[model samples]
Target: MTIIDYFTQLGSNPYFGAGFGLFGVGAAAALARKGMQVGMILFRRHYMMTLEVPCRDKSYQWLLQWITQHARHTQHLSVETSFQQHETGRVKTSFDFIPSVGVHFFTYRGTWIRVERNREQHTLDLHMGVPWETVTLTALGRDKGIYFSLLEEARSLALEREEGKTVMYTAVGSEWRQFGHPRQRRPLGSVILDDGLGQRILADVRDFIANPKWYTDRGIPYRRGYLLHGPPGCGKSSFITALAGELQYSICVLNLSERGLSDDRLNHLMSLVPQQSIVLLEDIDAAFLSREDTAGVKAAYEGLSRVTFSGLLNMLDGVASAEARILFMTTNYLERQVLALPLSWASDPFEHCSYYVCLCDNFI
Candidate 1:
């Protein structure tokens, strides 16, 4: 027998296969075994059982349920798996891993398997293997300032409940993925909004805290808009970046006109703004086409199609909003439109109030 045949024989030999598989499930050599019918494969202390069933989703589902129940003992450990796409539009499955769990929640790379997707139902299988805790948050602690800020915020949120207060917030996008969920808390940490000059910002910080709705409650504006306009090289962006650092809020950066966003995404984001933290719109004027009236209309109507004049009015001071949110907008326009003053922005009345303050070169 030649070398290739000899290696194949070694791999097929039950004694060798069982010994190697027992060493671990995720073992590279064991995973490569073709006619796998029995035994467990272990690699790097992580193990998974090999299973085969004619590429059927029902079989996959049954196996997935069994794995879930089997891995329940490992806390903070969840599965990651994927279906192997076959040539004839069919799918084959590999194996499920049993991962090690730790104090923080984690996800395995191969644990979540996409078995199939359709209109009616989306099926998946999670493998409990290769726990993410292998990489600890402690290693990333010193460097992850943004994440640490979020953790502090999480602590504050928890304490607020002790005082019997309801915590209301506005989150824009994926910020929650980092720090919102309890499982992800350790790695994601807290989101901190820093105004750079932390102590300096305290000048008006007390006012901001004492009355979050100071501007909104008075019917002055439902949204607090700030128009940062100045010649280039000024700290317009820096100032806002600093604010985000101090507030412990996750920032949502958007352009004046984003083509990829759909109407549903817009409404969904609007409806769920209170979950993440803040919405920051920079260079609002530069984001859209320079058709003054239309740009302003679209900038405000972003994510929706056919925004009527009346809808804009309601949005500026509408019946739907109740939370205290900071809607910050920036512009370097030749002539600024102050949100405080209704300047026929849309030539219509929106249900919500999007407040604004114009900063010209003089202020900068």
Candidate 2:
């Protein structure tokens, strides 16, 4: 072959591509080996809070907010803004991280930290790559203190969203969240009632909080359960909401008709009741009324909830039920309508009638 043709043939040889491919593979392998060694060092020194812990999980969201507020000067970042209509009829705007192409870094107290989303686990994984010898225990403690301060700041933001409002919470599936925010600014003094019931209810709650030891000493459960029954639209719900505001307690409204509300789910929801909050179980008789029952029942009530009458009783008297400072069950039924229902639904069978407080004459 001619010399020029021979060189052309050499350039077109399969080994030319193979040689470049081998060089690329070798480079990637060397970089990967180096990365593995660095990763091992990091894995040894890293402090990770995974998805399992609830508080830790919430801290991820808090940390995201912290980074957003403090890391605005970052040259590379993901930032997003959103507007939501709150239950108070107010529009709320929120800023979030939009997750850029790669790791986003922020410096806290001269310590550089990286935040990345762990999509598989659905959590935020934070990494600080300081050498173990360089980070003293005191420095670590300072870092933790700053971390908790961020958590508290996030908590305060959540509280600010709910300030001066009465929230009615209900279960959707297995989760209980704020169902609605009632705009009723009706104070307890404004609730029109007879028989000194308003004063009596307020005094009862004050006594309970003031003398928790009294109940504990007597081996009595530190819980107060009230049954409010009256005609429909006679301010039963409003009265309860007013009472919540008076006590400065958030109201959690439990609707047994909610889907996916089995006995276990109901019990779990009740167990999570916030300290000093009022749990209102409205329409007590209506929840149990099915298609088999007569015309007065709430219509089209088919749902996935399997909350039985016995289950309701069990949850009310259960150990965790006592965690709630007060529990209220309201109904728009007279003495006979309530008495006609099964007595086994009562926490204390003998006090079935005792729990009932007649409010037939009280109006809004």
Candidate 3:
């Protein structure tokens, strides 16, 4: 039968006609849907601008803080609550609401922006031990300058919040993560050291920081090392913390005795330390008793620490060591033979002797 005759016969059958009509309708509907998708894609590609902020980026924190401040514009929200205890024994609680995992809209400088927060459940951020998250901001038109301005504003806000505070960081899997909320800056005067000792150390640090060029012009490594040795209760750690606050620098505390911390990982972590931060190695003498101890006897402290003494030496002044770095090592035992090697290896070693003396009235 001819095609036209077959269609004519099929049309005569009610069921066949209905089936054919449904097929035609479905094909048309599918074509319309495809056309709409293509149109939307073209429109977005040609007329829209998007910025993606990943959770790993510092800007992500800034953007989130900004969003939290402007939470009133969001319909869906996520809350982060924190409690702070004052010296007066009063506890204060704060709740911060931010845009949740969904599409949100807000107005920025007379422009409508769409924010889409998405979390990938299948993916995990090993460093944070959480699901991967991304915040995408979409705006109409092609101008990117507005986005830059917005980011700058967010950064300014974040910095203002962090002003006059000390940030502490710790290594997590070769990455430096902020340990806790930024603490109030401790006044350098509050810490008491031996007569004139504190001032001398502070002056030396200021001088070194001020004269970065002197080191560079002479082909010297732009770094400084300090060894604070004293008895257990001599405030060695407290002094380091106070010094960091006085210098307006952050602190990166690394534990050399951390299990699974291999030489390569230690090197990597040291090299990637945050800028304007002090690298603190507390209890340096405890990491290893002696160079020979770690070098000769592997089974003695098996699975304790993968870092070897030679690896530590290499990380200290090795070719991969970070420039413009300040390293501080504190130990209770100054006479430990293990310290001899590292002390000699330091480029600019300042050994501070801390001792306590009691003075009382003769009348007593």
Candidate 4:
């Protein structure tokens, strides 16, 4: 029937308007019920089914690394580029995922899952259904499982690079903190030594690490010490860092002359040093003898360090001395007569010490 004719006929009856209103209501109700049904199915599957791992934790780091390796296959994702200074004083570029808030979807084991990074609180969250047994297996620490297999994929990504890089540090008030990366990637080869002292230093460190049990059996302290004496600008500091790099050990630089460094404070600093790392005391004599040291010591003389000739000795050895893998002390003094100003290091530590006197004729 034509719309005009049909509507005209319906308009003639009062029940026609009531029937149209009822039809509209029924359609709305059906759509609402369908929406609820879909929502209930999703709630049963994914609601409360999530795993969160913090960024600082080792497991999260491993997961991030895994994601970085598999990012190529992920269709929905984001990326960030970072520049870090390498050992040669050059900046190196690297790519990583931007751990920003948002959902990234991926397909794993024939199932779809989403990974999210919480912006406010740095964490990685995994969202998936019950059939996803890989996440459960990983959390349970099952070896050779699917999740662990993914972790192995990440570990194998960096086959050419070393696991850990050497870190450079500076004293921040009372604490030693990583300041920056060293410019000299070739720590062993960077230092310019006049004699074969450079080779000898490397050999000494190699032997020291190679024979740990030998020292233990002989009742030795299982520690080694080296004193590098030369003029300023002769690469004493550079050499220390290089030697540390060659041995794949970290370097902890200390400034004894730093203000507020008292005997107790020094001990505290020593106690916090990381194990199997090199401890460097640069310009031991200058710390006590420098004008800056004198002025600071004089102002806080009663409360702070006395800067005694033996004060350095007190910090160097004894129970408070840090259990370090190596202890390195450097100075510019060429003669013991000059070092005799305050600490009689010549008669005490130097006399009974295995030392290397790197006399640098040219400065780099």
TM-score for each of the candidates? 0.37, 0.65, 0.87, 0.54
How far residue 139's Cα lies from its native spot in candidate 2, in Å, is 12
Tens-digit lDDT track of model 1 for 131-177:
11121222111233433443345455444432321222222232112
Report model 2's TM-score to 2 decimal places: 0.65
The TM-score measured for candidate 4 stands at 0.54
Between prediction 3 and prediction 4, which has the larger TM-score? 3
Show where candidate 3 strays beyond 4 Å: 1-19, 87-89, 290-303, 337-339, 342-352, 355-364
Lowest summed lDDT over 10 consecutive residues: which window, candidate 1? 180-189
- Among residues 3 or more apart in sequence or in different chains, the pairs in candidate 3 whose N, CA or C atoms overlap within 3 Å are none
Candidate 4 Cα errors over 4 Å, as ranges: 1-65, 72-95, 103-114, 119-160, 163-184, 187-190, 254-276, 283-316, 320-324, 331-364
Backbone collision tally, model 2:
0
For model 2, residues 198-287, the per-residue Cα lDDT tens digits are 777678677767887777777766677777777776677878888888877778888776665788888887777766678888876656
TM-score winner, 2 or 3: 3
Question: What TM-score, to 2 decimals, does candidate 3 have?
Answer: 0.87
Candidate 2 residue runs with Cα over 4 Å from true position: 1-68, 74-103, 118-143, 160-163, 172-175, 178-186, 290-299, 302-304, 318-324, 335-337, 340-364
lDDT comparing candidate 1 with the true structure:
0.39
Better structure of 2 and 4 per TM-score: 2
